[model samples]
Target chain A: MAVPSFLARERIVAKPGFNRWLIPPAALAVHLSIGQAYATSVYKVALVEHFNASLTEIGIIFSLAIVMLGVSAALFGTWVDKNGPRAAMATAAVFWSAGFIVGSLGIFTNQLWLVYLGYGVLGGIGLGIGYISPVSTLIKWFPDRPGLATGMAIMGFGGGAMVASPLSRQLMNWYDDDYTGAAGEVASGNSVGFLFLTLGLVYLVFMLFGAFIVRVPAADWRPHGFDPATVKQKSLVTTENVSANNAIKTPQFWLLWTVLFCNVTAGIGILEQAAPMIQDFFREGGTSAVAAAAAAGFVGLLSLFNMAGRFVWSSTSDYIGRKPIYMVYLGVGIVLYIGLATIGSSAVWLFVALAAVIISFYGGGFATVPAYLRDLFGTYQVGAIHGRLLTAWAAAGIAGPLIINGILDMQGEPGNLVASDYRPALFIMVGILAVGFVANLLIKPVAEKYFEPKPTDVPEAASTTGDRSLTR
Target chain B: MSTARTDDRGPQEGSKGLVAFAWTLVGIPLVYGLYNTVKAASALFTG
Candidate 1:
């Protein structure tokens, strides 16, 4: 099959003076579209009723997609780096939109496996590729500040959920003709299918703009004020490149992976159960409970913090250095979890503020890790490395929910459980945060032994059609 | 493998006109997204 003309690697190479700032939005376009995966819960009840399936059954779709996200990203990281983002983004767009379209068909036919095959398997491949598509390009373009560039794109992924949750609700409402129906009545399959169709097309259009607009930096390109010599001032921030395979062999890579895994696990605990956790925490004298609406508001606020932290803290890493930035995420994160476990529920305002900060660290951890990789590993295949690192996210997503839910489930139902009921879980999170802090401290400069010796000649494979690499 | 390629965007890399067009084109969706979120978050208070 022929690649689309617009997505041709040679054609999309950035010309001299090409504005690199345009690259972030291109990244955002793809991230935002794929990030819609987070908003799948917006249709949860609707699907459960339509398919007449158990909640757990519907949840398998999400689980499969997430598992596939990690597997595919790790498997395809090298391919994406070799092919360049234009091909990756374009391929991701096709798979993502097609997933929705095919999932729409599954809904129409009332076949659950089709939904799994469509949205779970196919859409997940898109998610994996789309997630890492922009990192290399952005890092290459903004050599002076890899963190800031990646932060912008990663932040957009969180914001995509904010946008999609509301947008999806409205679309579902528009499609549902019988809004005021009987309790047992299921939605017409056509209504749900239509929503999927609309979403698929809309996302495809946005992603196409991203694919067409994205461009590769010229091999010799550098920003006006940038100097290669000055950047070497940070001893740990290497100019040396490491291929993704060699990167896995380094102790630094595993340490960073542990740091990301622990940080994400701690954050996800608060995030996964934000609404229920709040209600449980703020139960007043067994008669008054935090309003469900207000608890949801707290969730929305945390989403804002999550989105803001990505841009704010990650960009800050450029000035403070990546290691120091992680110190804040892991160290401060421990303190906040401890406070939350001990007495966060005593005051509503305190609870909100603490959760907001914790969530920001969560988003910060994600945004900063890619830049962190660039610091330790260099920009040669940073995107592939970042892709490999995202497996940590898939791991944390499960671990976080299990730790929180398991503990809470042991203490009876959420609303009846007092603040003390959550103390054990929150304290566990503190220990998790502590482990991450030490991992961050252990992250010294990657050993020189693992570094692939720089070669002057182009390798046989790299010299082929897709010759758009940093070494050029 | 050579930096001998002649593909540069020239001095006016992101010309004002192109910049404006690109920014505005993407800005619409983003701004709408922000607006939509504020509305939803407001529900927790107003409710």
Candidate 2:
């Protein structure tokens, strides 16, 4: 399919005078907008009430969106690479905004399935495409600091909820005069409907700004005082390119996939039940010492840590190298999981601090992976490879919640659970992190067989005919 | 949309301002979000 001329890859190539610094902000604009997906809990109650549906039914919307995020990213990864970031970002903007509009109609009409179809499926595709759009471009532009470049944008995803949560509350209150945006106050269905509409339109503008401002660095571009040859000196870093199809055939790719899956699974164990888990740890008699308000605050604190880790740890990876960073995230993470399970209830501060660090590592794992992929696979089809790798995230998303919730379900009812109740789940996460640790250790460089042949070796007929298959 | 070679001169004086403006546009909202999160998170210790 032909992209619009305006959105064509060649159309948006950067001029020499273009500031590389501008790219991060364009990436941020799209990420921060789509990151609103994380803030769904804010309106979850309203949706449940409006549709008069089960929590499980309402929850499936988020699950489906996530599943679709993985699916669309995997399916569309190459298309995005071939088309360039401008086209991908614009496509994401349209689908994402349309999701809100369609979902708003569902809310207004009290149809649960439409909300699922719109936000879960359509908006999910937007999320997938938007997520990977800027990643490879950032890596290419900042070859000198690929970790920091990718980190800045992924951190925006972590921060998006911070912006969306408050914004959504304020918007919902404005739309429904009867709603005061209080702790238990559920906005009217109409208010949520309007909120969706407003957000859809607003996010459309921001994403388009991102799309318009975005530019691919010219093929020959390199930062002053940088040497491409120096990049190959790092262990596991490669100068050769690997196509996305061939990438999956390499052991290194699956090892990294397992590494991501374990890290995400462990992190989600804490996040999925953050509020209740904290409360349960301090439970004395049937009543917890921790107040409901304090637990809410703990959840907020974790979000801050999660956001901060994406930038801080991934940037740190630039200095220490990507492999060492994963060792820290998974290895130290195991010890922290043990501490949380064993002694977490000993003090409130101990529990909060441990959980905070674990969540940060989880966030770091996400932000660091693109740079890691760039190291092993080269920049040739990194966006596509990154897109395929996100299937681990989708898998971990389901597995993590199930592990935590499943264990907790057996221990006792949520409100009545005690510190011992969480031990089983916490220990399981330790085991999961152990798996990731080994996977990270086992990751060697991609074998030379997987590397794409250099252009010089191409048959003249194939080259002249513009036929990729002959080269393959 | 202008065509220029990669070997050309670095960013001109004009684009410097555009870069700053772009950063500020994205920065304000992120800061706002961070501020709100901090305010809410304070209750973890205070409460």
Candidate 3:
């Protein structure tokens, strides 16, 4: 497929002395837009009422979107690499915005399957492509600080919901006078349709702005005062390239896969049941001391921690190195889970502080992995490799909810359970984190056989840019 | 001496106005989002 001339990789190459700072905002535009995926919970009740569907039925919409996010990213990882960020970002914008438009049509017409097809399948593709679009480019541009570069961009993803959650509520309120923006008050279907239509147009403009402004670093462009030799000197940091195809064949990739799966699964154990879990933990004499509003506030606080950890910890990885950081995320994560299960209910502050740090480690694991891959595989195809690795997140997405929700279901119903009811699930997470800890410890540098036969680019000026050339 | 090569099109400088404009554009919404989240999260302590 030929890329439109305006969206071609060559068209957006950075000129000499181009500002690298411009690239982070460009990445933020797409991520912030797609990050709306997390805010679906805000309108979940409204959709259930409007569509007259079961909670499970409506929940599938989010599940399907996440599953597609992983699938499309793996499938299109190379295409994104082949096309430059401009082309990939533009395509993601179109698919994402169109998803909203189509979803609006479904809501307006009262067709459940249309909403699924539009939001779940199409919007999900947009999510995946947009997620990886800026990754390798950022790493290439800021080679001196790969963790910081990628961290700034990925943080936008965690922050997107902060904007969308409130924005969607206001938009829904504006579209419907009868709909009070209060807990349990559902918005009308028409209001949701209009909201989708409005978001679609709004995101399309922002994402296109990102696409037009984003630039690939000029061939032979290296940041001043940075040495590739300094990078090579770090243990497990490779200057040699590895094709994404060969990346999968290595044991290190799968070990990292297990590490991500365990981290995400344990985190989701808390996130999936954050509000209710807090209430249940503190329940006394069949009633909870924690107010509903306070529980909601706990969820909000966790989101803040999650977003901050992505930037703070990932940037910390630049100084500490990637492997050591995972030890912090997974190793410290074990002790936190134990604290939560054993004595979380003794005090609210203790419980909140422990859960906040655990969630931050979860978010840190995500932001740090791209830099981790760049460490092991080099920049040749880090984006595609990153895309492949996200399938673990998709797997954990299913496994996390299932494990927690399944255990909770077996114990008893909500509103009647106490802290001990959750001990089993929290302990299971401890086991999961232990497995990830071992996996992180076992990760060694890729063996020599997996290296591309010839190095793709040297620190010298002889090497040129354009992703296609790098892969070849 | 660092073996790294530099692109000699000129010193790697960028326009201050453009950089400021770009950051402000994205920064405003992010700040707005952060403010709202912090306000909501405060309920955990106060409530």
Candidate 4:
């Protein structure tokens, strides 16, 4: 198969005095767009009614996309490393947008399979590729502040849903103004199909900009005055590089994976049931429940903390060290989960504040892991390493929801439930956080044997500025 | 005394303005999202 010229890997001709800071926005462009996947719930009901399918059947689209995200990231991590961000990002741009386009066709035809193949399979692969493409590049550009750099890019993924949700809702309203019924319960396949077309094209443009605008740091790049030796002063942070395939062989990899899995599973315990949990906690035996919209607002509030934590907690890790940050996430996470279980209904403020912070740690866990990987493995294939670790996320997604929802199911229905109903799930989350805490405690430096041999050193600024010529 | 090729060395000067621009990519949408979400929350909860 002949690879299109656009998809072909071409060396980025680095120019002296060209800004290294430009890279994060390029990352944000793709991340923010892929973040739309989080907002698919906005259209979930419409699709169900339109396709005349069960909720479980429609839910498979998001499930399959997330499953593919883990699979494709693991499968394509090395490809991303070899082809560079440009090629990987371009491929993601094509797949993500095409997924939506194909999904639109499915909606038009009312063929559920096309929607599955388009949004689920193709879009999921895009999510996987797009997710990791910029990680190593950001780490390379901001060698001194890998946590902050990667956090900014990853934070945008959280923010992307924030943008997409309202925008999608408004777009649906605009296109389907003729319909008069309650929100999210009504149907407008045509409006949704058009919305997909709009989203597909818009995402395509944004991702292309990301691919084209992104440039990798040269072989021997570092920020001005950053001493490579300084990182050695910190225990467990290494200057050595490890290939992604080799990284998993070491104990550090699995430890970090456990850390991610536990943190995510605990966070999802709150997230999967955010709205209902709030109502349940405050309901006082279902006498006066927290309104559905307020519950939604609560989810929105958690998302803010989540996004903010990605930037704030990860940036703090730059100063406090990544391990210590994980300690906070795991240790404090246990406390918060316990508090929510114990005194959650005591006061609304306390409940909201505790949940928000827990959610922050959840987002922090995600944004910090890439930097954590870079510290252990070096930037050579940190993106690839991060990709492999994301399987932990996919695993957590299933486990967290199953445990919480399964427990909830053991109780009666959602609206009628009280705080006591969710108490078991909350206490169980404490155990889950405790496991992550142990994993964080267990994480130490990678064994030296797993590291790749060092490449020959190159002096910074040996290269000239304004060199635009491509070499493959 | 460097034998490493010129092309291998990365950019020398950092651009602050561009950094500010990059932050805006996150900042603008975040602020807007927060506003919208707050509005939605208030309307949903208040009346």
Candidate 5:
């Protein structure tokens, strides 16, 4: 059957000029603020000092927050679709701001539950709502360039940490003197609490700007001079729209979930403990405390590559198919992990460069998946489906940290843990990536049995084009 | 309504100038916002 003309055209309804530019910054406003989650490492030292908590205890807060991000997104995604982006974004601003405020109270009172409540529960909800707010809308706006548009927003999520990591470090220094611990000591709790409040307020204002500027395109919008046939030339591209409910029923959803879960798990294993891991790895070689801090900067530098990869590599997925790009991520990732395991600590830069590439793939997996879904299911409730898929991220978030820290704790030896100690965790990441690689190979064009065409009573333009076919 | 329709003309030569002016107004803030963010980070790091 020939596709409708409206489906073939670009989906955005705005007049040419300012509106196109407006979409990305609005997305950045939300993504950049939430991206602070990446900078949680900066606060770890202070948290450990304040609570006298074990590494496991501190890691729980991040794991809990990530889990909540998936849950809340799954529950609220339908609401985001039903209401306009404005309402959803506005609500996200409120909840996210409140999370910081509550977290501040938790710190003031020295109550850990309140801290969890503020940052984990409330902040996580904010992360969920804020995350989906831009994704579906941007795809709708730039259906012709789904990868680029989504990448623009997702890159902000990756880069948000780059900005936050440095800024948080500076703020901790300013609020409390003794930014660097003399002789490898961690910072204090009070200093950490103050930093949280400052970030919360700044993010509040920035997210509000995003919420204010966000608007849905007029109903009949399409990109000028777009041709659907041009888009259909790629093998992975499809013109069908699948609802979130139907999408979950397919084998493809589960397969893609595995891919994402493995990708994130591998990256977070390094990310969660970058500072200590590097210190341990390089300690025997006379790597000073200054060297560790510089290594932490290298973590931030990896974030730069992570952020750029989200835009650059994922955008490339538009030309090459999603499957091929994913093969690169998994194939190269396996080799990199093996290199770290086998090479030992003799060459630090090799490990760093490989880790940097792997992290980029982790970030790119997130950015490109939405377009991948658009190819399979069309735009029909992709935001909701994407939210559902995020559950994989939540699962991976917990699993990743557990595997990394658990193995380390079990080893029970400190100070320059040899390559031998890390072999188990490294092997686990490789095995997980291999499973995801197989799953990617298994995905086929979504079968028609899974889709239910839009009801005829609905407006033709609104309903027929609901699936975001413009993305293909 | 009739007079208004008669007077209505397609985008004229002046329309191009108006479009340019609008872009300038929007583009300035976008560029400056990015510059300011970088400047803030550099100042914090160096100082």
Candidate 6:
């Protein structure tokens, strides 16, 4: 028997093909730039030494950038959905490039506010826009492989730090001759200014490549043999589409937000103080500065697991479902944090291994959440919902560093951070993750009452007139 | 079903080269970036 007209329409809309290929590069372009957040640690030592800034002061820069990423994303997400990837990516390029330039000026003038303006305010907008540009489009193109599609893009965000960390380190070395300058001493500002300028120009070019290559799939496109019924079989995976505005009102959105917030906060607690945390933990056991630097390098190593887990774990979600995977992330994550609090410092490898697993889940949480949204809300406005959801990230950005550094500051000793000293923070993270775990369990499928389908007139017009069937 | 036949014929036309080129462009960067990341991370951790 022939399929019904409605089924045929659905098939065409869900079809996948060569166009799906375009989404990844489009995503990579933006992710690569925002991924620099991961490598911010590489700059921490340099900034502290160059500006004679305290750790708390330097951390404020990262906090501001992250908070901005969330806020700008929420603000721009709906606009991004309406306009298309081209406009969004182009705007991201402008703000991101401008951020670096502004930051360069700040560095040259010895103005701390400019640095915050350039890197935090300007760069944060770029991070938010770039992050969501390809997300919904890719999910639409690869409906059958939502996890993998989102994973491919998010993996770029995770891996971006791996490239940036080494590249930034190399650039610093290239620009400045004195790597061995005294701890916390200011370096010549000219070199730093020039480096920021060069980075800005290069990123502008790459972001444009992403903007240009991104194209919505032809109308009436559907995957070669897709069966929507199969998707219905996966309880955690939903085929229904929800607009971003409606998604915010649902219990599912808040639950997922809490899950992401807890996961991010837990990871950032260790991440923000990675170098010092490792040094202090091992110092009592007689590990030296060289060993500590190597351990810092191990922290960089976690970015790989972070990157890999984004792709591997989230892609695995396509088959396993989103909720169960998050269960593993939170469940295993709690155990890992508990181990770190209790037994991490006893052996260096134990610390490294447990830290790597926790970091992987941290990265996976980001990669998987978009698909989770796709499952709950449909594709209609998933991008905007994803964008709004980032506010949780912004909150965590502030809360994470504050919880970690605040505790450390209260202790009143610069070099005396030990495993015992970290107990309160670690326990806080454990409780936060547990709360998120409960939220994950509480998440129910978004009800139909919450979903307002896209205007039939608009979708019908596009399907009949536009070349891309998939986007329709 | 008629539309399916048309879709099949279009893929048979000029799409082969475009598909190959796009896949290569996207795949190469992805593979290289993943390889480079894993290698770098390994060196940092193991060394």
Stretches > 4 Å off in candidate 1: A1-6, A180-188, A457-472, B1-14, B43-47
Off by over 4 Å in 2: A456-472, B1-9
**Residue A13, candidate 1: C-alpha displacement in angstroms:** 1.4
Candidate order by DockQ, highest to lowest? 2, 3, 1, 4, 6, 5
Q: Global lDDT of each model?
A: 0.83, 0.91, 0.89, 0.84, 0.73, 0.76
Give candidate 6 misplaced runs (Cα > 4 Å).
Answer: A1-19, A44-59, A177-187, A285-290, A409-412, A453-472, B1-47
TM-score of chain A of each: 0.95, 0.97, 0.97, 0.95, 0.87, 0.88
| TM-score for each candidate, following the candidate numbering | 0.93, 0.96, 0.96, 0.92, 0.82, 0.85
Off by over 4 Å in 3: A455-472, B1-4, B8-14
Model 3, residue A153: distance off in Å is 0.9
- Native contact recovery (fnat) for each candidate is 0.34, 0.67, 0.56, 0.35, 0.00, 0.14
lDDT of 1 by residue, A123-210 (tens): 8888898899888889988888888999999988988888787777677667886753333344566777888899889988888888
TM-score of 2: 0.96
Name the candidate, 1 or 3, with the larger DockQ value: 3
- Indicate the worst ten consecutive residues by lDDT in candidate 5 chain A: A1-10
Candidate 3 local lDDT, A58-81, one digit each (tens): 998888889999998888887787
Where is model 6 chain A poorest over a 10-residue stretch in terms of lDDT?
A: A6-15
Query: What DockQ would you assign to candidate 5?
Result: 0.08
Docking class of 2: acceptable
**Per-residue CA lDDT of candidate 5, range A382-403, in tens?**
8888899999888888899899
What C-alpha lDDT, on a 0 to 100 scale, does residue A269 get in candidate 3? 89
**Candidate that would win on lDDT:** 2
RMSD in order of candidates: 3.0, 3.0, 2.6, 4.2, 7.2, 6.2
Worst 10 residues of 4 chain A by lDDT: A463-472
Interface RMSD of each: 4.0, 5.5, 4.6, 5.3, 9.5, 5.1
Tens-digit per-residue lDDT, A220-262, candidate 2: 6778767779988899999988989999999999999999999
Better of 1 and 4 by lDDT: 4
Residue A159 alpha-carbon offset, candidate 4, angstroms: 0.4
Task: Name model 5 segments beyond 4 Å from true.
Answer: A1-18, A48-58, A177-191, A279-290, A344-346, A410-412, A455-472, B1-47
